[model samples]
Structure formats: structure tokens, C-alpha cells
Target: MNTSDEVRTFTVAPDDDGVRLDRWFKRHLPQIGFGTVSKWARTGQIRVDGKRAKPDDRLVAGQQLRVPPGGDAPHKKPREKPALSEAEISQAKDMVITETESAIVLNKPPGLATQGGTGTKTHVDGLLDAFAPGEDEPRPRLVHRLDKDTSGVLLIARTPGSAAHFSKRFSGRSAKKVYWALVVGVPEVHEGVIEAPLAKQPGSGGEKMHVDHEGGQPAKTKYRVVEKAGQKAAWLELEPMTGRTHQLRVHCAAMGNPIVGDGKYGGKDAFLTGSISRKMHLHARRLIIGSPEGGKLDVTAELPEHFAASMEQLGFDIGLSNAEPIRDDPPPKSREEKKQAARLHAKQYRKSRKGERRGRRDATTAKPKPKPKPKAKR
Candidate 1:
């Protein structure tokens, strides 16, 4: 656990033969997680015969195992946040997945804070640090964040370089961000831009950001009516040109069509607001980050169950978005799927044929002789 001290070495006796050096160190140190041990091994902190060894190296009798001394492991329990609780960790395990070397794409459920504050506990930052604490890097960083109640397309960068690269792209307005939201009213036009300057309201706890005076930062938001219904709700595709806080929510509200379930932005007409779809109707649907290396990096997060259900409830066509184009009306089946379906159909046909034959035989066996025998017995 001591980062300032030299790596501690201990002699493994002949009886301790055949165990993995990394596992042994972990068992002995108890504080070193697999990632830290792997990092040490990568950095030559662990050596065999005065040579660096991989984390999976098998230990020999009398082997001098070197355990590196640097960066203490994260405590068993998060200090500042309880949302990073054991329960949440298990739940988020499947939702958080790495797409590229530097960036991790996560499917955040609504109601979970992307970062912590307010009654917010266990933001995505803590969970990511706990999850992907890269062995090569000391601390991972978040490239961009999501609204506390908005779900999907959250990204975390593992290294500083990657973090900087992604942040620059986002800040420079190069990253293409797409969000799907449900609004209380439909815009007259199918697609349009809202270029309203936004400023923070005084004494607003820094949380409430709104369209302000002549000095506010330039903010623009573009929206498309993905689907529309009279006075019910409309599914929308929102793209923010500037990264002002609450730009989409505020702009939508200003347009007289506030996001559904938005108590802050949605006015008196907001009384008929729908349930918080998948945490909130707002989703970080698609993100495209152009790498300095040239080609663009595109990632998309599908509608979490809640959003999809809300779309279905609102009678909106819960199909593909304008983002990615896929072939076929009802997505085409893969080869494996076709083969499996064919096999199942064949089996069902054979079973049906056998049943039909049995039915015909039973019909033939029901003879007039049975009626005669019954009469004789009577």
C-alpha cells in the first residue's frame, strides 16, 4: 500500500511451488488488485531471474517475487459516494463496455448522475475508475458527461491524451452528439435550429441554467420532429451546436414545447407530462468523435427499455433513428438465425405429420362394431 517505498520482495518456499506469481502477490499483499499487479508486471516491477515477468507467470520454488510500490488501490468502499455501492456495481457491470482503446462507451440508465452532486451519489466517474482503472495509466478521466437523468452514450477516457483529444473535439463542437427526447408539443416545422444565448441565473445554485441577457454565451440547438401527435407528445432528434448546460431542455422550453417530464422547463401545460422514459426521455443517442489519426469514430447507444416503452406508449414508431442506416424494413436475419429457424420449422412439420397420422388411425379404429357390442351388452 506504500507508494513511496521500494517494492517488497519475499522468498517463496519449495512448498509454494506452481502458484502464479501475480496471484501469490495478490494473496500476500491483499491490497493489490489484479489491475495494479498487471501494471506492475508491465512496468517490470515484478521480476524473475532479475528479468521482468508477465502477470500470468508461474511461480517457482525460491522465486523472488517483487511487488511494486505505487498508487494505492481504491478502497473497498467509495468514500464520497454510496451509489458506487456494491449493488450498483453489479448492476452497471453489463452496461459499461469499452469500444476503443482510450474511450469507454457506457449505457447509462436515467436517474443515475453522470457526475455527483445534490442528492447524487456514485456518479459515473467513480464507477469507471473502479471498473477500468487501466494498468498503464494512473487515473482515468471522463471525456464528456450526461445529464443526471438522461441515459446513454456516456464516454470515459482512460488516458490523459485521449481525454484531451476527446475534450477538444467536444469543446470545439466537432463531436457529433445526437439525443432522442420526448417533448410536450410538436414544432410547426419538422426541423429547425434554436440559437438562443444562455446565461446562468444568479443565486440559482449553479444548477439552473437558462436563456439570459445580452452577455450570455452563444448557444444553439437543432431539433427534428421524429414523430408527432396532437397535444400528446412528440419524439425528437436534438443536436446541440454549443455545449451550454441545459441547452436542449431550455431551448425546447422556450419553443413552447418543453421536454416531457421536465418540471423545471415544462410549464403549466407540463401537467400532462409522461413518465420519465428510461430515466429521462433525453438520451445521448449517437456520438461521433473525429480522431487526429483521421477517420471518424462513431458510436451509438440503442434505446434502453424504458425509452423504447415510452415511444411505444406515445404511439410513435419505435424504429431506427436518422443516425445509422440499416438494410431491410424489418432488419434482415443473419445466416445462423436463418439456419436455426429452418431447423425449428422442419422439426415442427415432422411433429405435425406424425400427429395427423395418429389422428387418422384413431378415426379408422372407431368402428360400427363398437356400437353393436354395446347394444349386445345392454
Candidate 2:
């Protein structure tokens, strides 16, 4: 791997697809530092497929990277403690509902964060090291995220190639996700769609979202009422068509009854009285996605204790149904369709710029108001 004295080329594998050039170096050629990569990129010494590439440029599968010599970055000593603690290892092992050669399905518990963030000391990503079969094994990668307070089936790709494949399925909307939530009240319609657009609330530090029909990105959620607890609450099966942040919470709230215990979106109305717990009742009930190995990977997760207890208290059925989940998902766009869309967007952008220039020219070319009126008044 020491090509420090000679030029070398590397082919990007499926594992490295969509990875930034700088990140690729960090993973494949750790001896290269950020400064060295930046210098090489700036000087046209680092090339991707015969073209100079930037550090932030995303690499694709089968692309060749031409690397120049001089990767002499200093090596740092290893940390004293092992990556995973004993408790974290146990927690990670206990959370696994099932495992395969390419994937592991976890029934994540509520309040356990999927990844670390500010003020977060422990999380699923940190605990995943326990699943490593050997020191040389690639660390498991999270295919998707579950909110810190939402528990359910979470998929971990055991290999980088699997990670790349699963990621494509999710981004292409071929992956099917079914969620169950207990809301504060029953929706009027038994089944319906929420077509509200959502955007981040200004000044919330990205913590809140609101409907911004005019300028927001499109978001849609399809929901059906599985059961209702009189007028107090309802059990809903929800499927989000787009993977917008907090789309489910916002959509449910917009429907006049938010998921129970979702205080952020529903405010005080999201709560319910009696023996029911105040924990969020949303769960990722099932996930059906095409595996990298060429078959379907379908897994179901059981509800958490609080969610199950609430169901029992509210007289909702806790058993699984044989009914197939509804999937009206749109098909992935064809390559030609995507190219046409890009062309259309470019044409519209040019038209908009032309209009702006015309408006400016008209304003500057306009005749000045007659000055004689002021003198006559005086």
C-alpha cells in the first residue's frame, strides 16, 4: 500500500461509491492527510478518470483515481481503551432481532439514539462495533435512521457493498417501510393521504418543521386507521412516500391529531390521560427492502413496552394482521426522464435570469418624472 515513492491508481469499488474524494483517501490511503490531498487537488496532481477532481467531489463505482506519491502523514498512536465497552457490546448484541451474512435487523428501543449528536454519549452507531467478526471486518453501516424516541426495526449493512446497494434501494424509494402509531384522536377518514409540503422552521436550529406549501419540498404520507379507542385515540398505520425529516410527526399533527406523546408537533393536545405512558408511540413496525444478494429482506419489529402497554390499555389489538401493506409508491425515474428534467430546469433558470435582466433594463430606461410641477407649486 506504500506508493509514497511512486504514482499509483485505484479503482473505486461499490463500497466507495458516493464517497467524497477526501474521505476515500482517509479510508483507503490513511497515510494521506487532508492538507496533502487538498494540495494535490489544487495542483491538478490528483485526478479521477483523467480529470482533476476536488476533495469534495463524489466518487462513483469503477472510476479510477490517479494518486501521486508523497503520502507521508504522521501516524497517531492507538487509543488506550477498545472501541466498544463491555456494556455497549452487550447492549448491541441484545438489540439484534436477527442477523444475516449481509445484514442485521435490530429492534431498537425508544430513547436510544441511532447515531451520536450533541450531548449524546452513547448510541447505536457506537455499539455496532460488537458485530465486527474480526479486526479486518468492515464496520456495519446504518441504512436509515430512527428518531431517538422512536423504536423499531433498524437495518445494519454488514458489508460496504451491501451498504451501497441498500442505500440505493432506499433513495430510489423501492424500500417499503411501515410504521404504527397511536394518535391522540381518530382521523375522520378511515384512509387518506397528507400532501403537505414541509420545510425547516426559521430560527429553530433545525429542530422544528412547518408546512410551507409554496417553497417547501414535497412530502406525502398515506395513513389508515387500524383501530380507534372510542373518541380518545386511534391506532394508525402510516407510510411516508418521501423521506423528509419529521414528515410523519408534522403530517399527523396537520391532520388534527398528532402521534401520542409527540409534544414537539402536537403541543399539549398530543398527550392522553389515564394509565398510558407519555413516551412517543411511533414504531417502525416492518421494513421490506431488496437485499444486495438478490432477494427480498422483510423484517418485523415488536412494539416497545410503553407502546404495547398503551395498546393494551386502550383496547387496541396487539396481534399482527395478515393484510398486505398498501404500496402506491411511484416508480423510479428513468435515466432519460431525469435528463429531460435537468434540461427543463436549466431552461427555466435561464428564462428567470432573462426576466430579471429585462426588469432591470426597464427600470433604468424609464423616463424621469416631470420636474416642472414642483416649480409651479412653489
Candidate 3:
């Protein structure tokens, strides 16, 4: 809606209230980027109640908003790429490990992205349309992501409803993801937790993360050393208690033993000498997630060729990779159950605070020592 020649005023709907001004525009006028909105606000072209507003200002229901004209143009949809070649289609199909009515599990390979981005033309998401060529079915959507260099079990939702169901499971922490990595050095502790918070590293162009205690999101990881090659390298199974970008990589680095071949975080120390492949030695080993129709989907992906070769070279027991599933059958909580849990947590917090205050009051009101009288006169 960017072709309008005249200014327009609109009232914020209840659904639109409390969202940032930029979000409001994105909802009603998808074509207008936040940059344009900010420019308009800065130049007094955009106003709320005749006053200039910031892009981040929260919108209120019933507020009068003045929008400059650019709303008449037809909305632009993403450009559709040419159809995948037969070879490319076959290649993508080969990656699929299994499929259900609602979901597809893929053993994604290294160096292949899950989704397309800047200069990323070939990815799993782009090739999904090849699965149902010449059909009217909707293209499958990616429910979650794995790093391009990290190969293994990636999930795709076949329908919008299924996507919503799976997204909720992941965001609510009901999905279980187990990763395996070969680290450059054995951890001092056989098994332990990493509870450091994480945030994006500044000026790294959003490609790197660092452990930041302050102003960072809480992140936790549980790791176990499965096998070791003396003090040089180790095979580790990692479970992320809280999902953050590159949480496993960052936590391993923080432990003074970065994942092997992760040059970004580990530098040259990430590599192993000799015949071992220097490709990133991380893999998404297993996933246990709730199914849309019923129970759980438990799947394990075999390691890629390079990873297996590296494990062999490091003298790591390949049998350790076949160990029993670490996490299984994660039951998803309903929205109502989550609400009840929040209420209970608040009640417990209030009760504990009251008890603490009572203990402090009793200590403060304790009787003072009896005064010593006339000792000086005696």
C-alpha cells in the first residue's frame, strides 16, 4: 500500500495496541521498512496525535495516527526462484530420513543451509517445493533450524497448523535436542553444567556470540565427556537447557575446550593435525519432539562422513555414538497448565518473602542486654 497520493489517518485496533510503532506499520503496511518509518518520524512526516513519535513508541488503542501517503501500491510478494533441476530435487530428497503426515525429519548435510538468506540461494527450504511438484499442496515450512556447518536431524512442518504445534513445543522447552561434538581438549570434569549467560558479540556482524554475565540472556548447558584421546581431544554429548544462538559452541569455548574445527570461536586451536578433517565437528545427534497428532517423534541421525573420520582419527570409540537416547518423551504442557504453574510460582515467592520478613523482625526485636549500672562508682 505505497501508491497513495494523499495523507491518511487511522485508529489503532485493540489487537494492534501495545505493539511498537514500527510493528504497527509492518502489520498494516508490510512494504514499508522500519528505516523508512524512522526517517518519516525524524522528519515529522509521521505523527501521533499531531506530535512526532519514535519508531519504538508503544501504540495505544483509539489513538489517532497520521501516516504519510505511500499505501496505494500493490504489496510485493517474495520473488519465486526458478524450479529446482532434477538432480537438485533428487539430492534434496536423499536427505529425508523419515516423514509423517505432519512432519518430515531430514538428515541435513554440512554446508547446506536450512533457510536462505543473503547470498544463500540453495537451502533445504528452497528445495522443499520439489517434494510436491505439479501439486497444489502448500510448501513445507521449516519448524526449527540447525547451523549450516552442523549436520543432522532437522524438522519440517508440512502444514501451517503443524508448524504452529511444533513451534509451540520448541519455544515452550518441550522439545528435546541432543547434540554431539568433538572438542579439542578433554573437560576436567566428566560431566557438569554450564550456566553462563550469552549475548551476541559486538561488531561481529551477528555471526558470533560470547558469554556475557550482564545484559545477556540466561543460558545453561549440560555436557558429558563420553570418550577422550588422552588430554588432546574428547567426544562429548551436550544438552542445552536453554536455547541460545550457538549455545553449545559458546559453552564449550568457555570451558577452555572449544568444539573441534570451530575456527570462529576456537581459532587455530580448534583444529587437529594430520589426516583428520578440519570440518566443524558438531552434529545434531538426536531429537525427541511431540507429534502433532499424538505421541512423540524420536529420531537419531548418523554422523556425517567427515565427523566419523575425525572420531576415528582421534581414537574415539565409535560405539559411544550409539549410546541410548539421552532425552526422550518430552511431554508438552498445555497453555492452561503453564498459566497454573505461573500462578503457583508467584504464590510461593510471596510466601517465602513473608517468612524472610518475619525472621528479620524477630531478630530486630530481640531483648537488648541488661544495662551494667554503677560499676564506675564502685
Q: Pick the candidate with the highest TM-score.
A: 2
Worst 10 residues of 2 by lDDT: 73-82
Once fitted onto the true fold, the runs of candidate 2 whose alpha carbons sit more than 4 angstroms away are 1-82, 320-323, 329-378
Query: Over the stretch 168-222, how does candidate 3's per-residue lDDT look in tens digits?
Result: 8999988888889999987866666889999999999978999999988999887
In order of TM-score, best first, we have 2, 3, 1
Candidate 1 per-residue C-alpha lDDT over 179-292 given as tens digits, one digit per residue, 9 for 90 to 100: 888887777555668888998877887778888758789998777777777757788888888889888999999888887767777756654544544244687888888763
* Alpha-carbon runs more than 4 Å astray in model 3: 1-81, 321-378
Candidate 2, residue 370: Cα displacement in angstroms equals 50
Is candidate 2 or 3 superior in TM-score?
Answer: 2
With a 3 Å backbone cut-off (N, CA, C), the pairs that clash in candidate 2 are none
User: Among these predicted structures, which one has the highest lDDT?
Assistant: 2
Better of 1 and 2 by TM-score: 2
TM-score of each: 0.61, 0.71, 0.66
- Report the poorest 10 consecutive residues by lDDT, candidate 1: 324-333
